[model samples]
Target chain A: MITIKDLRKTYDGFEALKGVSFSIREGEFYGLLGPNGAGKTTTISIMSSILKPDSGEVLLNGKNIYTHSDESKRIMGVVPQEIALYNELTAYENLTFWGGLYAVTPSELKARIDEVLKLFGLYERRNDKVTAYSGGMKRRINIAAALLHRPRILFMDEPTVGIDPQSRNLIFEVIEKLHNEGMTIVYTTHYMEEAERFCDRIGIIDNGQIIAEGTLDELKKNSHARETVVVNFNNLNDALLQKIHSFGSDFKQVDNMIYYYTNNLQTELSKIISQCNDAGGEIHNIEIRKVNLETVFLDLTGKQLRD
Target chain B: MIKLALKDLRLFVKDKRSMLITFAIPIALITLFALAFGGAGNSGKDAKISLQLSDLDHTEASASAIQIFDSLKNVNVLKVTLEQAQEKIKNGDEACVLIIQKGFSDSLTAGKELPLELQYDEAQEMQVGLLQQSLIPTVAMLPFNIGNAKAVMRNRFDNMVKGSDDSVHTQIHKESDGLFDALAMGVMQGSGTADIGAGFFGGDIKMTKLVAAKKDNTLGLVQAVAGTAVMMLLFSVVGIGVGLLDEKQEGTLKRLLYTPMNPINILLGKMLSANVISIFQLIIMFLFAAIAFGLDIYSHLTGLIITILATAYACSAFGVVLASFAKSRQQVQGLSTLIILVMSAIGGSMMPIFFMPSFMQKMAVLSVNYWSIQGFYDVFWRNLPATGGTFLSRIFVLILIGTLLNSLAVMMFKKNILKLS
Candidate 1:
């Protein structure tokens, strides 16, 4: 369990985090979702006690992490965005070194290294230097290194980025297993689908502030985001686009397809069809989709998840 | 092709490290070499061969010879007692000493062989050669300057003339006395050579050249091994220390800091590793020198071990300081190379300190290589005991230098590398 209270961080004259606070319960999968430069990594860095916030306190299981850093750090592990590993050393050597730093007994460190190596499916290449590993394999080893000491809480910052789909799936499976085994995890990323599928509670942060926080269904209901009606046009032009815009102001365009959001989808769809016919535009297909986290995020911040 | 070449030129100019290495290092080295080779003002006067003179004979003949030897150019004469001279030569302070025996004047007056002695260390063969060449002609002309050789020749000629009643023989003897006087005056006034001819004074003066005995005959080899070992150890430890920067660049240092340990432990660990490597490197270098060059390592084994440990610690600390001051691996490499080379040049690794200007010799104390090489010289060249005052002082200074540098490095490592402040 972790409690971050009124965390404020500044770099030069720019304020990176302004009174940002959040908490994670025991054995809960908490997601900090935001775009790049949206204070997610800064928050995770402060929570992990690597970066000191200007004015704040992070309590790990009711002890100040900054004051009792060694004790707090012993129960926590961080997987940074960068592949923080020594390429000249083998995976086994790197793991052993980290294990030693964590004060793991030598008798137990060996078994832990082998267990994590096999968990990441890198046991066959454990003897080879990390320079000879593939990008995905290196990413796996990066994640595997943090699990050597089996901390109570794990902080993963964008671990699945720039990896193959198979590797991503395997990482998610291991993380999910950890969570199911009552290990608390604080996962930070800009991927909406990962947050939706895996997070028990999601906090949508933007511009150093958490604007929305709840479960998936609770977020959709609280955000008041309407269902989206996707319409494809055979001959979309400027005139037809203007005619469709006149019907509803809440919409996004992608080439010939337009995503229109509204509560009264039937009336808006009929009116768009008649207007397209009159404007000499052909309708290709139309589909009505339920509101998801993407729509909820757009409704809350007026921007895409990646922006 | 021209565009490609221009692009490369642009890149090279943009890189400050490359530009510094290309232009700055050469300029610095040239300036150091010039200073060492007597390019600056009065450097020729400064670079003189030191000679020690011990006059056991208090006679006029020995004084005259010493005065002539002292008046030679490019030689500085120091009058010392025989005991002092022998001690200096034994401790490698003085290369050679010229000793005039007790009956030098008596032997020259009686027309017997001259008693002169040269006690020198064979290790400094070049200096001994200079001493011999300078003293040879001075010794050859000593008879004319002292004992009134012209008068002696005149009296002999007169006696011969009186014995032989022939007028032709008397006149010839008289003319020969006048010629001898003219030659003796010319040699005494130091105006020109007396035309004494080669091999004429070969037996007149008995110059005994004695070499001081030592356990090892190869002092030059010892100097080379010790100087090169210290200088190269500095370089090797610096390379090892720069691994800290490499770790910072690769992000592993941050990962290490994330563990449940004091951040200073990381720096201490790196320093320890560098020290270990430096010790091993020095041992290997000395072992090779002992096997190949016949260096006497067994005689002063304790002193050698102490010097090596202290030197390794100091050099390793120097490496850490360089790494702490630099922000990147490239910066560390460029800065360390320039600094180490300059230190080596001034600290008597590339050349002897006596060859450099007086100011540069004074500045050599600022270098870690200076202390390290001096410590090794104490063990191998001087053959001083490990517990001797001078040798122990050197070891103490090395340890003190290491402690100071380590403190500075720790402060900088926390503030700059770990961003603790």
Candidate 2:
């Protein structure tokens, strides 16, 4: 388990992270979600021991990692956003090299390398230079390198950005498998869908602070606009669409989907039907679904997940 | 640590630029020097000159002067008639002409001489001066020896008792031969004290002539080539280091740094790989020049090895420092080029320390290259002992550079990588 308290990182007079606090329980897969410049990278760097916090205490298993950096680093792993790989080296060679950085013996490293290689599906191209590997293959090796020592907790910042669907799925499967094997993970990403599907819990970070943190259902419950109801009418004209937009503030038309962000799905659905019924527009398919994280984010911050 | 070194070695070897800059170019340069430089030994085998005799004396005595040019080495004897010779002077066929006038022999026999016109192109004064200078020595030898011989023959005939043993000429020949042999042999015996390789023993090595000043002795040339080999070895090592920076910038270093091993191990591995590169470069350059130019590199192979070892350490350490300080591959290149150019310039790689200003020479002494070049000069050119104190001192300087630079590189890398400084 990792515990962060009163964590603050300041450069000059601008604060990157300000008095943030959080904890990741043992064996929990946690996602740190934020937009650009949300201090996700800075926070991760501090946890990885690559940067020191201005005022903070990070405890790993009841031990202050800052004070006992050497011992704390033994079980810690970090996979940076960038592909940290030597292009000239073969996949196996790169893993073996990374394996040596930890306390793994040569025999131990060989076994671990085989396991990770097989898991990442990089076994076939293990002997080929990394320069020849595709973007996804490189990303797999990057993650495999982080798990060389089988750390209790692995920190990966935006691990699946810019990967193809197949490779992305492979990565997602690997993460799920690791989580299932009781390896605690601190995964940071901007992909709302990935966070919604994968994370046991997530911290929605904004402007270097966690604006909200909870399980998927829990965060949605707090966000009053938890359900989105939408309907389309072929008879709806420009004036009527503008009049309907005034009735449902968050309603919008694009293609055939009318997006309605709402707190009460059934009540808002009835309101939409009665208002459009008098306006003489036909009601197309009308259905209700619970709001995901993006709605909670839009409700909380009035901004898109990507921005 | 060993893991890092192996990685560095493997990457460097796979890099084609490392092979090209460090090994191929140096070897090619050595081969060029060997094939281009013709051995400049003056054994009197190939010489050329021309002669124009006026024959004004129309006597055998004056004509005998013409025969002297034939005995000289490489003297192309062109016999030009007086009118032809005069016209040739304007056309510059010969550098100078020896015009023998009428009564020249009579004037000489009368113990006086006529002015022998030396007709040459007035516009080519320097050429005329060279021709005249050469003639002065040759003319002096002929007149002195022939006059002396003729006087002796005349005196012997005047004293001849009709046939007072006509073997007088034979007897006198034997006596003259004995005296000449005694004087020549005495001079030779006096000078025979010089050792065969005295110059190589750090004595008078320069057999430099008035002409061909740039043509160096075979030993000295070999030694200079050895110095060049050491210089380029440093460059190749730095090139290898720059390559390491490329890997680091590409994110390879960060991954490697997180290994369970000590960072020092990684640094040492890189240093060792760089050392290997430098050593390989030196070997190839030396071997190429040694084989192609007939250079005597083996004269002090052990000493050269020691020098190579020292220079390799220094250059490798330098490479580490460069790699550590650089943030990107381009920066690595800029910094290495700047440092190498400065080191090469100050280290007597481009010019011998002997020719540099004293201040510059003192500065060169502060560089690793100076010691390397000095070591090579001593061992290869001077053929000095490997255990000589000078060679040992050079090795010390190189080791010092290695130690200092290696430590500094480690510190810089740690600071920058940790983002502490």
Candidate 3:
């Protein structure tokens, strides 16, 4: 379990984190979803004890992580966005060095290194230098190194940012297995599907603030984001656009397509068609989009999930 | 082609490190070389040769000789006892010692050959030659100062007359000796000989050249090994220390910080690796010197080992300091190259420190190369014992410098590498 309270960090005159706070229960799969430069890495860096917050505290099980850094760090592992590996050294050697830094015994470290390497399906290339590894393999070893010490909590910051789909799926499966085995994980990503599929509880952070936090369904329900009825029209004019705008206040128009948010999609869809026919605008297509995290994110932040 | 050239020029101008290495390093190095070689408007006084003198005779003649040497504008005379002079020569502090033998004044008064002993180290063949030449004018003027110029000339003319076999040569020598006798008589009234040829002291002072004992290696080999080894070791350790920057760039340094270990441990690890590499580099260099150049490494094994260890430690600390001051690997390369080369030039790595100007010699003590090379000189060329005071003092200063630099490096690592600021 971890608790971040009013964490504030500043670089020069720019505030990176402003009164940001969050909490993750033990064995909870918590996902921090945010776009680039949304302070996701900064928050993870503070929690992992790599960066200090100007004003605030990160508590690992009720103990201030900054004050008890060594103790807190011993129970936490961080997989940074960058591939933090030594290109000149083999995967086994990198793991051994990291494990040694954690004060793991030689015999136990050796066993753990082999087990982690195999777990990542990189046992065959353990002796090869990381320079010789593919991008996906390097990413796998990066995660494998963090798991060598087997900390209680794992912080993965966009671990699968750029990799093949196969490697991404494999990473997802391995992370799922780790969660099932009761390891608390704090995952951060801009990918909506990953957060939707893997997170038990999700927090959407933007501009150094967490705007939304809850389960998927709870987020949709709390956000009050209605299902979207999307319709494309030909020969649309300003008159037709004004008429469509009169239907509801929650609407977005781009080019000739309009997205109408309505709780009564069935009734709104028929009325929109009739209005379009009366306005002499030929309808091209019509579809209904169910309310999901993407719509919930857009509804809460007024922007796309990646924006 | 012009566009490509302009593009390259733009890139080069943007890279400050490359610009510094290309322009600044060369200018600094040239200035250092000019200063060392006395080419930058030097008055030649700063290039004085150190001459150690021991007045065993203690006569007025010997005193006059000492005074004349002291008054020379380009020679520094240090009056020491015979034993002290010998010790200085043995410790490589003085290249040669001039001993005024007993009865030197009597011999000069009687116009017999003057008794003088010049004990010198043969290892410094070049300096010994220069010292020998510098001593000639002082020795030639000794007879004039002691009022024995007429007697010395008379003795020399008599030998010439006696050795001549032809009647014509004897007549010519007698007539020339009469002219010199009149001039000596006129000039001798005031105890002054204003002009004398350098050859006048050739046999007048029965000078004995005694080579100092226990020097077997050539000076060139000694200097080359010690100088190249120290300079290269500095470069190598700096190269090794630059790995820290590489780690920082590659994100491994951040990963290491994420661990439970103290951040200082990473710096210490880097220092340890650099020290290890420097030690191996010096060992291989010296071993190669011993094998190829027949250096007497075995006889000075203990002293060599102590010197190498201290030198390696200091150089490693220097490398860490360079790395700490630099923000990237390219910066380290440019900065270290400039500093190390300048240090080497002024510190006797490229040439003997004595060959530099006096001011440069004083500043040489600030460089790691000076202490390291002097330590090696003690072990190889000076033939000093491992426990001798001079050798041990060098080792002490080296270790002290290493400790200070390492402390500074640790603070810099905290500020620069860890961003604790």
TM-score of chain B of each: 0.79, 0.49, 0.85
- Which residue segments of model 2 deviate by more than 4 Å? A228-260, A265-290, B1-224, B355-359
Q: Provide the global lDDT of candidate 2 against the true structure.
A: 0.70
lDDT of each: 0.81, 0.70, 0.84
The worst-scoring run of ten residues by lDDT in candidate 3 chain A lies at A242-251
lDDT of 2 by residue, A134-213 (tens): 99999999999999998988988888988988889999999999999999899898788888878999988888788899
In order of DockQ, best first, we have: 3, 1, 2
Winner by lDDT = 3
Q: Taking the tens digit of each residue's C-alpha lDDT, what string does model 3 give over B273-330?
A: 9999888999999999989989888988999999999999999999988898789998
For model 1, the TM-score of its B chain against the native B chain is 0.79
Model 3: per-residue Cα lDDT over A155-203, one tens digit each = 9988998898888888988899999999999999878899899999998
For every candidate, give the share of true A-B contacts it also has.
Answer: 0.74, 0.45, 0.82
lDDT of 1 by residue, B102-166 (tens): 99888778645568787876655566776667667666666666664544454445655666667
Error of 3 at A4 (Å): 1.2
Steric clash pairs (candidate 2): A100-B260, A101-B259, A101-B260, A102-B259, A102-B260, B1-B265, B47-B74
